[model samples]
Target: MTIRPIVRYPDPRLVLPAQPVTVFDYALRALAADLLETIHAAPGIGITAPHIGVSLRVVVLDLDPVEGARTYVNPEIIWASPEMILHREGSVSMPGVNDEVSRHARVRISYQDVDGNLQTEESEGLRAVCHQHEIDQLNGVFWIKRLSRLKRERLIKRFEKMSRN
Candidate 1:
């Protein structure tokens, strides 16, 4: 397993939609492993393939507060509840800043596992929020996008001011 470098925000590549995995072969599996390594190395809860310069519909997340990580290939949110839950969200791409974002309180996701087995799981609370955030990355969307335009602008300005000091 290799720790892949993460692509930060405003990198341009993050906006491009990811490609679908065609050959679910050894290389693909290796990529997944590398993604897990990279996420763990960053000590992050989730990562998307595009962050590592791989434009594929892949995401890895460790919502487990205790042990174990979960990898998702072609993950899709099949169902989401209308109830909104606001959580303080941050991103590996957008480092050092966290903002409150509202997301579905519960969601059901379906994806293929590492062994090529199809799996579906229902999640709530932090796990649900993480899944939504990671899945958004898979679609080239960031948490900031969920914020209002004025809020996003202010956040960007704040980051820029901090960077100069």
Candidate 2:
């Protein structure tokens, strides 16, 4: 496993939608492994392929150590709860800054395993938040975009100031 460099905030690549994984081979597995290593090194609960400049629909999440890490390829949200919840969200690309963002309280997603097997999961609470966050990343929607204009600007300023120090 190798920890790859994470793309920082405001990078155009972060806003570009990632392509779906067409091939499930060694390279895909390698990319997933690298993402796991990278997220661990980033000290984050979740990460997407786009965060590392890989435009593939891949996500790695390690919410519970006992549950271990999971890799999702070509993930898509199949359903979401109308009920919303506010959660503190941040990005691996944008460190040292976070803000509360509203997201669905529950979500059901359909995705493929690293080996290209189809799977589905229903999640609520933190896991639900994470699934939405990472899926948004894959769709070229940065977490900050979910914020209000004022909140977005403020957080951008905070991230900018932190970057300079």
Candidate 3:
């Protein structure tokens, strides 16, 4: 599988919601494989199909190499813990910027495995944060939006300056 191009921040495509994966086939498997490669190349812990301009509800993650790559197709958060925690958040799309963002410390997610079988799992700490972050990407919300207005503006300005060099 080829390493697909990742859609960058501020691109309209990144803001558009992804469509659900209705077919589980070779193409879907190939896309997940490509996503795994692309995310590893991007050096990110997780990635969504939308990250590569593929408008499908899919995400790939490998927070721990020992656990290897984990794929989530048609993923959704079914429940979130009331007790919140602050975890630093960033995006492969935005790069070079991150900030502490509050999120549910634990989450229960319902998603399809790479084979398209329904699977559910609960996670906490960094793993939970990654899930929420990537799931937001699937919903067309950029991680930076979790920042305060001042922070968001500052980060965007910083990103702009970096882009100019």
The candidate maximizing lDDT is 2
RMSD of each: 1.5, 0.6, 0.8
RMSD of 2: 0.6
Q: Model 2 reaches what TM-score against the true structure?
A: 0.99
Pairs that collide in candidate 3 are none
Location of the lowest summed lDDT over 10 successive residues in candidate 2: 156-165
lDDT tens per residue, model 2, 1-165: 899999998999999999989999999999999999999999899999999999999999999989999999999999999999999999999998999999999999999998899999999999999999999999999999999999999999999999999
Residues 1-165, candidate 3: write the lDDT tens digits.
889998888899888889999999999999999999998898888999999999999999898868898999998999999999999888889888788999999999999987779999999999899999999999988888889999999999998888778
- Put the candidates in lDDT order, highest first: 2, 3, 1
lDDT of 2 at 10: 94
**Per-residue lDDT over 1-165 for candidate 1, one digit per residue giving the tens place of the 0 to 100 score:** 999888877788888878877678888889989988988888788888998989998888876757687778888999999999999988777777778999999999998876678899999999899989988888888778999999899988887776678
Q: What is the number of backbone collisions in each predicted candidate, taken in the order shown?
A: 0, 0, 0
- Which should have the higher TM-score, number 1 or number 3? 3
Q: What is each predicted model's overall lDDT from 0 to 1?
A: 0.86, 0.95, 0.91
Question: Which 10 consecutive positions of candidate 3 have the poorest summed lDDT?
Answer: 88-97
Off by over 4 Å in 2: none
Score residue 150 of candidate 1 by CA lDDT: 92
Model 1 residue pairs with clashes: none
- What's the candidate order when arranged by decreasing TM-score? 2, 3, 1
